[model samples]
Structures are given as C-alpha cells and as structure tokens.
Target: MPAKKTKPTWTDVKKNLASFDNPGLIALLHDLYTASKDNQAFLHTRFGLGDDVLKPYKATLTRWLWPNWLKNQNTSVTTAKKAIADYKKAVGQPDGLAELMVFYCEQAAAFSSDVGLDDESYYDALVRMFEQALKTIAALPEQQRPALWTRLDQVRRLGHQVGYGISTSMDELLIEYGVDARRSR
Candidate 1:
C-alpha cells in the first residue's frame, strides 16, 4: 500500500515577524493607500462624479475606516501626518474630491489604529487630517491630475472584488490588463 501524505502543520504556516522588514511594511502601506484611493475614484465615477453622487461612497468609507481606527497599533506618527496631508490635497477638486477625502480618512484611520491609537480622539484627528489632505490634492496641475484619477478607477474595480470578500489572484488582474500572466509577473 502507498503511504499517506501528511497535511501541512500550523507551525509551517506561521511567518516570523522578525524576518519581515520595514520595506515590506512600507510597500504594504503603499499598496493599501493605492487600493483605497482607486476604490474611491471608482465609486465616484460609477455614481457620476457629482457632489451629490458621492454620498454612498462617503458613507462606506467612513464605515471601513472607523474599524481600522480602533484596531491598528504600530503606525508611525510621520506617516499618519503625511496621509492626512494627502487626503486634504485630494478633497477639494471639482471631480471626485469627496470620495478621495473619504479614502484618505480611511487610510489615516487605519494607520492610527495600527499605531495603537484606539480612542475616539484618534478618529476625530483622522477626519481632520483627511480633510486637509483633500484640500492639497485638489491643487495639482491638470496634466498630472488625470493619471491619479485614471489609476484610481482601476484600483476601485479591483477593490470592489476585495470588498465583496472575493479573492482575485494577481493573474486575474494581469489578464484584465491584457498581460500574459505567466510572463507578466
């Protein structure tokens, strides 16, 4: 008789936190930021990019961020400050601004939560910080503006799949972009 194959153990599944470096963490932060921003843009555009059209997305953003504000415990002070600034910069534009603000607030809240900020005060601070970031992004040059906006659309679509608790492999995203998955990565 053939020998039975053994299943992988939990000990094999666990990753050593110490082996993980700052760059990986920073990259994750960047990815999360991009995903949130993209999702925000997608929501705004899908609903018509008008002030009134942003209500649902805004509400959703608040819901997503509020929990993060209550859970993260290792976020850096400087990074949190920068995120707020970006949020303010992105908020005052005629197109999709409010949605971007929502994204920024969510990011800030996540960072704060990660850094051990679990109080209502942190949530309030994140709101104010995100507002500031929105104001700043609204001031960019028109030529440079479309890139971020466009990328946000892509991000939003992918985010929707993630938000729905659907798992999308990187290959799927690559295929959507018309890249040959095996070669692309």
Candidate 2:
C-alpha cells in the first residue's frame, strides 16, 4: 500500500525558513510583498513603517460595509470583519484596534441610515460591533476613552434612527459599562 501524503504545516515551513540566509529571507519576503497588497499592508503594519497603517484596513471596511449601490457593489459583513482580523494579526495595537472597530460601526451605521437597510443580520452585526467597540474602548486609557465613547455615542444615535431596537440595545450596553450614553459633553 502507498503511504499517505501529509500536507505541509507551519512546522515544515519553519524548518524551511530556518535554512534560508538573511538575503534569501529578504528575497522571499520581497516576493511575498509583491505577490499581494494584503502582504504589503501586513508588512508595513508589522514594522510600523507607514504614515497611516490603518488606511488599507479602513478602505477594506468601507468597501465591505458601505459599498457603492449604484456601482453594483455588495455589502459583506464577513469581509469587513476580516479586515479587522487581519489588522489584529499584523499589529494588534489597542488604539488601532479600537479605531478600526469604531470606524466599522460608524460606516455600517451610516450605510444603514443612508440606504434604509432592513436586514436583521446587518443590524445584529452593527449592534454587536457597537458593543465590541465599547468594550475595546473601555480597555484604553481614560484620556482615550472619551473620544471613542463620543464616537460610539454618535453611532448609538444613528442606531435609533435605524430602529430595530438597535438604539435600545446600545443603551443597555452603555449602562452595563457604566457609560452615560446621553450625557452632555
């Protein structure tokens, strides 16, 4: 009987990588960076070498969350969420992660408001992201918390306009976090 072939895993890849010289590794990374924009973004983010590391991630979120209707673009919560996951993998900086999450909620809410979206799943995603943003923001320093919370407050207002109990759920989450969502600021 023929032996079964095993698929290559990270261990195999790491062993191969360990054999490469500095120049060889550089060449391999160059090839990978050239192979895809995602790789380029990942490299730039991992090294903190870009003026705005979050730009590519934000563009992806905007594309998936607030697709151009007239251009026949389609919304994709999964793809939008994937951009956040990718950013997390590259750097996972708390401020950057919070910014991306808040931006996601903003874009999704804006799309729902502008397009009058009636999809329950979309609203559910928006609400879930809102809570996630709140939770992430809570972990940041006190000085950073105010601005992010203010932005989420704007998202909550947009949710009210969207209906489907989005605003109600947001209010409850804010209370759970001890936040005065309607406070004068």
Candidate 3:
C-alpha cells in the first residue's frame, strides 16, 4: 500500500518563500499580479478612479485617535503598552512608539490611495502595510483592543467616503464592526 502524503509544514512554507528563483515564486507573483489587475479594473469600473472629489482627512483622524477612542474605556495601560511593544518586536521594530509611527504612516498611505493620490503599485504596497499594522494592533489585550480597532474602522470608513461618497458616520462604522463606541469611550 502507498503511504499517505503529509501536508507541507510551516518550515516548508518558509523555505518556499525563501526560494527567490523558484517556479512557485513565479506562480505566486503571477497570481498576485493578476489579482491586483482585477482589483484595479473593479475600482476603475465601479468607483471612477480618475475623479478626485472626496479627499479623506487622515492626519486629523489619526492624531490621538487611539487614546481618544480608548479614553473612559476599560483597559489596562500596562497591557496596551506591552501589546504594542510585542507587536513592534514581531515586526522588527525597536519599540512600540516606533510601531505606532509606522502604523500612522500606513494609515496615511491608505488615505492617499483612497483619494486617488497613489499609483497602482504605491496603493497596493500601502494596503499590504496597512494589513500588517492591523494584525499587529489585533494582538493587544481584549480590553485595550477596542481603541486601535476603532481607529482602524474609522480609517476604513473615511476611505470609503473618499472613494465611494458613502457617508459612513463614526458611530455607524463602529456599529458595523460590532464595536460599541460608546462603551469604548
């Protein structure tokens, strides 16, 4: 009887990613390229990417946004700090403060992309960075997690408003994400 084949392990996955000249990498790149092309086509067809009508206010939205949203919420500062620090470490940063800076930068880039200020490559890069930042933010303690998640939702809502003229209010955005903004505050 033939032996059953085991699934590829995490080490195998890492090795695959490390093989820069591998055919698998070429296939993965092609998949990503095609997906990006499809995404751009959809955006252009549905949202009219050329029109710079609604510009999202990213700076004001991100400034103290986390703290402000977290204020009056039930969260331990120690846990929040520790989670931020861990996230920084995971992402190869020196400290949580630096991670916060990177997070804000990614948010700013997302805003720029939503506003049609970024080219296809830049926009795609920013979106990937934003997703990484979001994953880092999600590793926070449950009590302290709402603040960062709320800020992210607000950013997405603002992006939607800019891109699609969808008037998604802060409260509505929070509700949509199942985050009780009132409780979070």
Candidate 4:
C-alpha cells in the first residue's frame, strides 16, 4: 500500500522557519521576491521598497489617487474604482486595499475642501469608495478593523468641518458599519 500524502500548512511552514537565522530568513525573502511578480510587488509596496511606492502597481491608480496627478486627470470615477480593484487583487491583502481606499478618500476630501465642491455630489464618489472598502473588510480578522474605522472617521470629520453637507458626514456611514458615531457638540 502507498502512504497517504498531505498538503503542508502555514503552521507547518512557520514551524520550519524557526530553524533559520537572520541571513537565512533574508535570503528566503529574496528568493520569494524573485520567485514571482506578485511576491515582488507585495513586498515592494508593503515596505515601500521600490524607488516609487507606485512602482509596484499599475500607474492608473497612482494617477487617480494622488492629488497633484489626479488634479490634472480626466479620468472617470469608474476608472478610479477599477484601479483600486486591480490594486487590491494584485496585492492580495485587504489591509493594503483599505489603505488605498482611505488614501483616495483623503485626497478627495482635500480636493473637495480646496475647491469647496458641493458636499452632496462631491462626496458621493468617496462614499462609494468607502462602501467598496467596507466590502473588503469581511476578509480581514476582527481585530484589524478598528484602525481602518479610525481612518474612515478622520475623513468624515474633515468633510464635516468643510461644510460639504450632512450627507457627507461620517455618522450615517459609520452607523451602517455598526459603529456608533461620537458626536461633537
């Protein structure tokens, strides 16, 4: 009779890693970075290891998310949404995706504040971005959510202070996320 074969697990891999010294671990990571484009991109972006943080990603997202670049962009919101989706898919981490989402909203909020774009429609796209970000949270462990929530709240506070309108306020969306908003007097 042939012996049964089983797949190795992450725990098994982690256990194996304990035998390596610092140089060995670094060498392993080097090998992983060389093994695949996805691994290289993940490490580069996560650690900002590249000459440009956006070097690991498609330029579409960097152009859409950054203010100086996005200011001159003629792209549609759908294109921006697709850029984010592509980034998230490539990175394979919800936390990374959430960071991109928050970064976009923060840029949009600043743009809105600068031009005083009407709160209602101006923040509509941002709300959609927020909603999409919310979708990604389900893939993350519970403990990781609070930081994301805090960043989202920061955007909301910025919008509220800028007088964009009640629709753009943080409480309504936070409620949807099951987080009670702490109102300021």
**lDDT top scorer:** 2
Flag regions of model 3 displaced more than 4 Å.
1-102, 105-116, 162-185
By summed lDDT, the worst window of 10 consecutive residues in model 3 runs over: 52-61
lDDT (10s digit) by residue, model 4, range 89-179:
5554666777677666776666666666654654677777776666666467877777776767777777775674533545676677675
**Candidate 1 structure quality by residue, lDDT tens digits, 74-95:** 4343443443334334453444
- Per-residue lDDT of candidate 3, residues 1-185 (tens digit): 99997998998888868967678777775676578643333334234354521111122224322233335532122333333343334333322433453455345444454444424443343344345545554455666666666555555555564443222433343454466544654
lDDT of 2 by residue, 1-185 (tens): 99997998999999999999999999999999999999999999999986999999999999999999899999999999999999999999999999999999999999999999988998999989988888898899988888788888899999989999999999899989988755625
Best-to-worst order by TM-score is 2, 4, 3, 1
The model with the greater TM-score, 1 or 3, is 3
Clash list (residue pairs), candidate 3: none
List the candidate 2 regions with Cα displacement exceeding 4 Å. Answer: 182-184
**TM-score of each candidate structure, all chains considered together:** 0.25, 0.97, 0.34, 0.56
Off by over 4 Å in 1: 1-79, 82-106, 110-118, 146-185
* Total backbone collisions, model 3: 0
lDDT of 1: 0.44
Q: Which regions of candidate 4 deviate over 4 angstroms?
A: 1-62, 65-76, 118-122, 164-169, 181-185
> Weakest 10 consecutive residues, lDDT, candidate 2?
176-185
